[model samples]
Target: MDIDTESTATSLDENTENFCDNPTRDTIAEGLMGLIKPTVDQLDERVRATRLSQVELRQCIEGLSEELKRISEDQKHSIDLEVYLKKLINAKQRVTVLSNILQSAQERLNRVHMSIDKETVKRKVLLNNTIEDPHSVVLSKNIGSSMSLQTPLYNLNDFPDVYEPSEDTHLFIDALEKDMKYIINSKPTLACEIGCGSGVLIAALAKILKSTCCYFCTDINPKACIATTRTAKMNKVPLECTRMDLTTNLKCKFDIVLFNPPYVLTEELEIFGCGLNRAFAGGLRGRSVTDRLLNNLNDILSDNGVCYLLLLKENNIGEIGEKMGEKGFKIKLVIQRKIPGEHLFVYKFSKA
Candidate 1:
């Protein structure tokens, strides 16, 4: 009963080869799966952070508004001066809350990116080894990857620019950019964005203009300025960020001047500490900062320059335009949007 020994040897060889291939495939799949898990976990953490902060920040802003009202009424009479001071002190706590919200949001975003980097590196290793189906593996890895890894308008880390598109801020930025596209295409030169919150629109403008002779960016908040700097760097847009309030005169002359002032009106009085109040609360009708910015805008813009300004309709856009008209400025309606729960008009005005 002599078996066909050569045939038996060939069958064993084929079986061994099949066994090796199956294990190799399994190893590749396992490595890819491992790489995806951490990134997904990290992304979930970021989404949670963003949601929590959004709620917290809104609450802080509302609290600050109430405190402002109390302080305003207190200052009307001389007897309540001491009480006013105490209220001012309490407002500082609200500012702290706002800061914490921003910090949390930032930390969560960082964690997501870190996780993405680690997973990407590991996935690449697996992909390289599985050359027989590298493309499919890469596609699978990407589908399973968890991270808000979309290329932002710019790099937030390097640009330090704030690009908060949610709520009223989004309306302000989107409208301003649309109107300016015409001028940006016609005249490509130096431009400056004042109070560049998140720098979302500035980055868009930079992308449009392509070659700017000089781009100056300013924000009164140190954090915002830093963010703007990072955003500019991330987008590869050349710009300088400075801490400057619109009430003060700016040194450089720009062909284009853009600003979106905090138009929310609050009655809080703080001599030295403006806090989060300065960021958004416009006085009585939310036009305090807008008025000041408009008053000083003429000083910063070139004689032949055009300026694009953002103001909420609730903040008295019509009244603002009337005042600018009296100042010998020509106003053009750039964009008007009635967003649910928000009302604003972005105008393009030039001194005549």
Candidate 2:
């Protein structure tokens, strides 16, 4: 046992050396493991956070996509509404235009109806009565009578602005011719013609009567007054012409009053000026100018005065006669003539 103790000590020394080397290696391995484990734990936490952020980003993108889809739908609806509103506005404008056109058409139709009714009445009257032709009557009387054939003294070129004598003028003169005997018998002291266009009617009256009665003529148109004066001068008739409005300035009453007036139906706006248009622009069924004259008849006429008024068939002669009757005046249809598309009449009014 004593001789083996050295060998045993050598074995123990070898065992201790081995144990020390192993502890050194184990300590280094444990330190490396500590550092590596902390780094690995931090990396794992970062990865988890990145995954959570990715999930949130995906949710936010889907929400934005849904919002965009709703906005697109809303914009489409707004565009549709705008288009519908424009169409409605256009339709309203078209309706307004059509209403105006319809109103104009209705007015025209009413005028036509009136004309047709008038023509029908005239045709019936012609069938019932042996109405003499006015032109033939005038010609026959002229041929047999000693009275000279009266014509317009003023030439058309003399007063271009004055209303030229037309068929109406001839009709008026013919009517006067038919009533010549009555007029001569009445012995008018003062004769006046309202709205004397070319002084033809007054001039003829002066020539027919051949009496020394005062003859006066009035016209709103200054050119007409001048033409009237010129016509009287040319015809060697003693005529006094005045530029006045329908006996407005005259104080003396007339024994006889003559008015041709503007007997064509027209709008009031067309009768504004004292031009040639005023000669024929009778407003509202051709009675605007005539009604004024009728209302003022009592004031301007003498006790035994006679008013000769020219009127169209459309003027409603029955209504006019009634109105005159109410004014204490008797009305007589002295003469009537039917021309193409129109009927003309001369009404004689005198105090009852």
lDDT per model vs. reference: 0.67, 0.80
lDDT, candidate 2, 217-281, per-residue tens: 99999999988888888888888899989999999999889999887666567677998778877
Q: What TM-score number comes out for model 2?
A: 0.59
Candidate 2 weakest lDDT stretch, 10 residues: 135-144
For 177-267, candidate 1 gives per-residue lDDT tens digits of 4554476555847788877766655776676576755777777777777777777777888887778775255666778877777654456
What TM-score would every model get versus the actual structure?
A: 0.54, 0.59
TM-score of 1: 0.54
Candidate 2 residues lying further than 4 Å off, grouped into runs, are 1-149
| Native-to-model Cα distance after best TM-score fit, residue 189 in candidate 1, in Å | 2.1
Question: Residue 190 error for model 2, in Å?
Answer: 0.3
Where does candidate 1 stray beyond 4 Å?
1-163, 247-249, 268-274
